[model samples]
Target: MSQFKIRGGKPLKGDIVPQGAKNEALQVICATLLTPEPVTISNLPDIVDVRKLIDLLAALGVKITPHSPNEYTFQADTIDIDYLYTDDFRRRGAALRGSVMIVGPLLARFGKGYIPKPGGDKIGRRRLDTHFDGFIKLGARLRGNPGENFYGVETHSPLQGTYMLLEEASVTGTANILMAAVLARGTTTIYHAACEPYIQQLCRMLNSMGARITGIGSNLLTIEGVTSLHGTTHRCLPDMIEVGSFIGLAAITGSDITIRNAGVPYLGQIPSVFRKLGITLHIIGDDIHIPPHDHYEIDTFMDGSIMTISDAPWPGFTPDLLSIVLVTATQARGSVLIHQKMFESRLFFVDKLIDMGAQIILCDPHRATVIGLDRRQPLRPATMSSPDIRAGVSLLIAALSADGTSIIQNIEQIDRGYQNIEHRLRLLGADIERIP
Candidate 1:
């Protein structure tokens, strides 16, 4: 496995630019199969997951042309559906989580779709029931058993629209069913749908392509089925997860960094949540400026109890950044409780940080209590392994602020979500390099 060798205890300064949103790109790229015309997409992030999805599209005979490094035009005029049954297709499709999205557009236009059981990060139990359940509700017949290696969804006739109350607000599940519903015979109503900004952007793009969708930023979504859709252009927003990671990096490393074109308006509660950690940041136009600090503090609740930071749906702090927050709080002036409600095992990475001298108590699988060191004793670096994307970057942040050189293994997890991370960090005066 590739590892990162980082010399710690040095501040990083300069401007950094986050790439386009990875989640949104996965959704919209699959939407291209809804029409035969060319769909031009710009601001696409070049990461492992995104590349895997694009490769899947190409394998299905979607003609892809690159206009620039971050822009592409896709035309799915002719698709080789038979390829889905091949070994190559099954092996490639199961490599990334986003592969399931292709089923929606295929079933919408071609009346069938097939995929192997998909794979992704091993954070915890991630169920695909939400996805297939929505498809079955839309009058499509499922073609395989629950635990089978390969499954399929097909409809003999055009799908009929109906109302569905999602069990949970799953982003990919909603995107999948929404794509299928747009071509149904009548109106479809979805309650408790995911309303994240990326989902909202997908709705806007669909609307521009002639789909009748209402409730752009709310949980309730209404879609009037259209017979067909046309081509359109879409530019993805900057990744908020990356922005939050950078903010955490600045907080722990005592650095002054300016993040350009951060799309601050869509970053709901992220800035305020960091502010609660006593990290000073200024919003100038669309850029975020975090100044160098000697030390930071954690704010308590209004009743003066220990502040509890948790994750909820949109308009609430994202669970993706909780790892960043937990790592940032290592050297803060006070204590806080981090509740990771959605995923059980995300907080497990704290054991590695504790080895580096952060005072953290794992209350359970879902909660961690952090007592900040207040910079009284700097962390002593040691070798560690990255478990996932967020946790990997969080460890990188800790290593940068620690007193000695540190080694991180299995960084392919980091590259799955981040692009040229070591190169980018080096540009900001960070002492980080990749080693074989």
Candidate 2:
């Protein structure tokens, strides 16, 4: 267990490149299982969750070759499908939630896939029924041992394409279903699908590998199954959540920083939402530049109601960045409501921010009302524990702007998402150090 000891009130400067999208890397890396040919992925984020998935793939006998620090060529020419039944497999598969993504490709290519109940952030009720429901729709049977938490998705025969109206626009659910549909016979239509850039990238990558998919960027997706898929190179986009986090960091700490290669086109509503918080940012081609600001004001509704920033599906603000937004609001002018609709308990971190002298009202498990200090009251540093990945970094951002030294334990949560976060922030002049 490592912790971050950070001395606050130091403004970070210089350009920092965001890591390749962790969510996209998870999807694309899992897609590698759909093909036996060499699939090279570039701009892979060197984060814990991503690395865990790579290791799981290797454990399943995927040939992995590292070309550079953030690039890998995966060849799943021969997979030991029986490995899914091992006790070691159960333990490894349960380590990270991304482990569940492997089941889709395995079920489509081979006839069976087994996964233990996945482990991840304890944000809220994140159900796997959507994933298993999609698998069942694709002509697979879902099985579970009476006493074990393990799940088995088996396809005794060829998967036939069918129409599936996803219960929710779950990103991982859509990715899993899409992977299976690619090798399925005939055509498949998915309504209410997740059309996030992550899903779009996965769709495009699968297309390059010979799967026919259309209606990207929309809730309706059509996939024409191909008997087999070849391998291709795919480069992940810059993590938009990291970009948003950096923006909030700049605002909270009054820092001047430039995010390199931010993939501006793919950052839907992120910049505009930050702008609503009165943060000044400029789009420089593919990069985002955030200038130092001593004070920023939260915008209210046009009809004179309190400003409410809520998480929604694609094209709306991402739930992953809501934690960042909440922390940034602590120093902004005026009040705003942070609604974490998709998950409960995410707003529980507000207590830590409140302890740092931010005025916050935890209305419930899903909502928080923040009355910004407008920088008049500096946040007092305090020791805290990281609950999850997003909230962990949000707390880190708060620590960067607070007045004294703060220690954040369970930094492994932060490492699960951000790649070399301490080193990256250090380059920007942040007074942060990791303590084991």
Candidate 3:
């Protein structure tokens, strides 16, 4: 495992451009498999997960050409359908949760899809029932063996689209179903579908590729099945999670930094959530500039009650940024509740912060109470292991603002989502080194 050695008490400066959206990249890359035409994708982050997915595509005989850094063109003209049943595919696919998305496109175009149980961050139970159920409703046969840890979906007859009201607004499930429905036989209506910016982007891209989709940016979607789809150029939105993380990093380190090309419109409720913690963000065109501050105080409610920040569906605070929010709250003047409604085990990383002298109470698996130090007393650095991707970055932010050198182990988790993070932080004048 890799480790980061960070010397604290340094304020970062200058401009940092957020990378491409990790979640969106996964969906769109899988969408490329829906068509045989060459698809060009720009502004992709060169992170571990994205690279792993690309390698998976290559392993399936998809021809990929590198145009430049952050740009690639993929042609899935001739795929090795047999590769889906191989041990190599199962081993690699199980390591990434995003790999499950491949099943949608493959089942749509090839009439069969197989996946070993997918793996991801150990935060909570993410069920695949929504995905398989959608396929079954669309006339596919499902077979799985829990003992063998394998799941398969196949259709001998052509799929006929039907109305599906999902039990939950699952992001990946929505993407998977949308991909499958685009090539199905008839019109499909999906109610309570996830309408996140990533999903909206996928809808737009699919439409550009000849799929008929309506009601974008809203939960209800109607798709008219198309005979075939062609290639299209897609540039992913700038990563909102990374943009929010940079905001937390600047607030924690008292740095003056500008996040360029931040895609401010897609960052719903995030800037306002951070504002509750007394961090000021100035939006200049498409950039967010954070000025240096001596201290930031958490805002109380209008009724003089303690503030609470919680995650919800789209246009709400994202669960992915709750860790950054929790870390940033450690230096504020007042107290607040950080409620993670989506994932259960994500809040356990607060113990590592408590060891560093932050006042945090882990109320349960899903909620935490934080009492701010108000920057009067700097945090004492401590060695810690990163529990997950978001927690890893939060710990790095904590280490950067601490009073002594800290070593963060298990940084492979961080690399899974972020691209050249240590190098980017170094460019911002942060005192961090990636030690092998």
Angstrom error at residue 167, model 3 = 1.0
For candidate 1, write residues 1-436 as lDDT tens digits.
Answer: 8999999898999999999998899999999999999999999998999989999999999999989868999999989989888999989999998999999999999999988888887778777778888888899998987667788899999988999999999999899999999999898999999999999999999999999999889999999999999999999999999999999999899999999999999999999999999999999999999999899999998899999999998878899999999999999999999999999989999999999999999999999999999999999998999998899999999999999999999999999899889999999999999998
Where model 2 places Cα greater than 4 Å from the true spot, the runs are: none
Residue pairs in candidate 2 whose N, alpha carbon or C atoms collide under 3 angstroms: none
Per-candidate Cα lDDT values, in order, are 0.93, 0.93, 0.94
Count clashing residue pairs per candidate: 0, 0, 0
lDDT of 1: 0.93
Rate residue 232 of model 3 by lDDT.
97
Per-residue CA lDDT of candidate 3, range 1-436, in tens? 6799999988989999999999999999999999999999998988999999999999998999999858889999999999988999999999999999999899999999999999989899899889999999999999889788899899998778999999889999999999999999999998999999999999999999999999999999999999899999999999999999999999999999999999999999999999999999999999999999789999999999999999998977899999999999999999999999999999999999999999999999999999999998888899999989999999999999998999999999999999999999999998889889
lDDT order of candidates, best first?
3, 2, 1
lDDT, candidate 2, 205-255, per-residue tens: 999999999998899999999999998999999999999999999999999
lDDT of 1 at 217: 95
Let me know the TM-score candidate 1 reaches against the reference structure: 0.99
